[model samples]
Target chain A: MAKVLMKGNEAIGEAAIRAGCRYFFGYPITPQSELPEYMSLHLPKAGGVFLQAESEIAAINMVYGASGSGARVMTGSSTPGIALKQEGISYIAGAQLPCVIVNMMRGGPGLGSIQPAQSDYNQSTRGGGGGDYRLLAYAPASVQEMVDYVQLAFDKADEYRNPVLVVGDGVIGQMMEPVEFRATAASDLPPKDWATTGTGGKRPPNIINSLYLDAEELERHNIHLAEKYNRIKENEQRWESVGLEGAELVIVAYGTTARIAKSAMENLNRQGKKIGLLRLITLWPFPEKGFAELDEATKDLLVVEMSMGQMVDDVRIVNEGKRGVHFVGRSGGVIPSTALVEEKILEILERSE
Target chain B: MVNERTILAGFGGQGVMLMGQLLTQAGMIEGKEVSWLPSYGPEMRGGTANCGVIVQTEPISSPVVEGNATSEIMMNTPSLDKFEKDLVPGGKLLINSSLISKKASRDDVEAYYIPSSDIANELGDTRIANMVMLGAFVELTGAVEPESIFQALESRLGLARAHLMDINKQAFARGAACVKEQRN
Candidate 1:
């Protein structure tokens, strides 16, 4: 396929169309507004539905309803908007609906700056809304991946029968890069036998609801959800590594920060600093296996994020006390330059030296 | 033959973003990896606007004009004032002489001056100034074959814009001529 230059947000919307996502419901939010805008303009042309709901809450609920009916559906927003959709997200998880949610994250605890951040790491991975559940989330570092992973997220959502998150940031959402989209078949996806499609008197009507009056039944459902999460952990973990062999330390990052970290590591290695990078593509499963077989020569790990040490917590857990996990973060939308990240890596290495 | 990190800055209406897009599009036409990132938020809505573009033979890691930039294009005086310090010494600077009074003060950098807007007006279209500046940039760096830019232009502006193509080509040549005259 011939490459065409595309902005990250537009590419995401187009990739969803290619992946058979015929419905998109979203409200406008900065950094990700272009995504819904793209959908609003293109979805109808593709014979799909695009609705700008009154609020993020209504939009995500609409997604829940559509995905419950077994149509590939999606919704997109930034951090604050994603926060608003949390209640519906939890409901979707409870109902075990297959859907895609994209959060092009911006700085926040409250209405923070409209700059890129990885602050939503905890909100996305650890079931931000409520309950004991995990949503499969992928952090894409490039515009190409922003397109490629949207398709992957849809497939993964159907495979696990759960909500899947494509977590990017303002930088990844706004930047332009050359990309080419290809057809992704949902043919390999498991049959959606649980969809709320009408039975046509062939059998009992399929019911789709999350509310359970019986706590015992809810617990049984939770067990089933937990088993699916474990299967995702086993089969769906994905990551990328650079210069791991005979390296002393590796910087762990995802999304925009991961791209910046790669540049820093490349420059550092050219300067003869024995630094490397391990970028997490799957943020929710946390790619725990990425750290399992670290080179014995590896002495430390650095978790770099555009937040106040959120994913570092997971890195610490995944490291299992094998090595000290140092953290370098720039939060509230301030991105660390490649030089700054390199300085942080150099500082960590110098302290050990 | 260094990978190019470029900063293009001007007023919001001056087509600075489009200029950056054209450059990256030309890069893609040449089968090179490229990235373009624009200034967002209030700054874009305000008079000031800028974009960072990188054209690389290999994958570009960060879209920002990291470690300063190797090339700078200033469309007006304010942009020159802002980005003058950011251009690497021994780098290239293309200035819109039609708008700026003071030149880049740095002596180490090779600066090329063009009255692109004036030239574009002479060619009967004011907007082709961006194409004029692009012509000079391409001349200095050999970033892409000259014809690839026109193909990219059609892809971005559509075939209906074909009418403007000849003037833009003239604007490009005028700007490239200015650079050649300076060398002579």
Candidate 2:
């Protein structure tokens, strides 16, 4: 297949289609509006359903309904829109429905800005909606990764019978890059026997519900969800480490911020500075194993993000104060330049010295 | 090229985004790594529109070229004023002299004053001014081959707009010629 130049948002839509996701219900939002637009134009041609829901809340409920019916389903929105869908997302998670949710994060708190941001890190990783649940969130750094991870998210969601989230900043949604959709191996997923496919009077009708009125039954349900989350945490921690060997400092970043950190690392390394980068691919699992393998010479860890400092807490938690944890971030749609990141790293190294 | 980070800035209708996309597409056709990032949203709706394009030999680290732009293609004066400082020292600056009156303020970077709009007007279409500027960029930087851009154009325009190919090619040649004439 020839590499085609495509926006990240469009690539995500194509990836979902190629992954056999036949149902897309989404409300349009900036930075991510292109994804739904692409779906609207292409999904029907691929023999799929693309419905523009009345609201984000309605869109997510549609996702829950579609996934519960044993269909590969997806929905996308930006930060504020994702907030509106939180209740539906919680319901889907609680019901253990297999679905994919794409959040092209924009600067936020409340309709903050239309530009790219990583402010949704905590919201995505720590469960934005209520309940004892953890979303298997993958934060993709590039357009190519967006394609690959969205496909992976579908498989993972089905395999675990849980909702999977692909979180990226607006840059990943807006930028255009050359991408070739390499073929992914189809996972040997188990049958959706629990799906609410109408029974043909051959067996008991499977009911998809999160409600367990009895306290003991609810506790058992919570325990089952916790065990599934633990298994995910154990098996799905993915990360990439660059130039970590004998490095003085390692920068922890994900999504578009990791790309900036890479550029900064390259520039500083050209100047003979020992800088490394740890890019998180899976944000929910948090990839603590990458930190454990850090070179002993690494004295400081810098958490770079597009938000004020959401991922910094996770870094500190994993680091356990063993290394000097620092944070450098920009909020409200401003991306930190490579030079600014280099300056921060130098400043941190100098202070440590 | 190790890395060529180019910023193409102009008003919304000036085809700056298309120019960036063309460069990126050409780079891709030539089997190089490329990325195009536009300053989107309201700025694209009649405000100053700009896009950052990176064409490089190695894998790109970031798609943004804010503080380390290796080249600036300014189609208007406001674009020149806004993006001139972003170009690194020894970078290349191509100003559309037909629209922008002032010369580049920086001395460290090599500046080319190409009246791209004028050249496109001579070629019978002002919309091809971006192609003219793009041609000058190709001649100046050799980031991607001129032939690669033609292939890119074929793929982008397809069969529907095939009639406009000749003028676009002419504008591109005129742009490269303008740079060659300046160098001589």
Instruction: State the DockQ of every prediction.
Output: 0.77, 0.89
Instruction: Please tell me which predicted candidate would have the highest TM-score against the true structure.
Output: 2
- Quote model 1's TM-score: 0.97
Instruction: State the lDDT of candidate 2 residue by residue for A272-300, as single tens digits.
Output: 99999999999999999988899999999
lDDT of 1 at A261: 87
Best by lDDT: 2
How well is each residue in A1-353 modelled by candidate 1, as lDDT tens digits? 89989889999999999998999999999889899999999999999999999999999999999998999999999999999999999999999999999999999989898988999989988867878888999998999988989988888888888999999999888888999997665467778999989898898988899898999999999999999999999999999988888888899999888888888998889988888789999987978788875788888898999999998888887788888799998999888888888888888888888
User: In DockQ, how does model 2 score against the reference complex?
Assistant: 0.89
Q: After superposition, how far is residue B35 of candidate 2 from its true place, in Å?
A: 0.6
Report the poorest 10 consecutive residues by lDDT, candidate 2 chain A: A125-134
Candidate 1 reference-contact recovery: 0.72
lDDT: worst 10-residue window of model 1 chain B: B38-47
**RMSD to true structure for each model, in Å:** 1.4, 1.0
> Candidate 2: where is the Cα deviation over 4 Å?
none
Q: Residue A212 in model 1: shift from native, Å? A: 1.2
Q: Rate the local accuracy (lDDT) of all candidates.
A: 0.89, 0.93
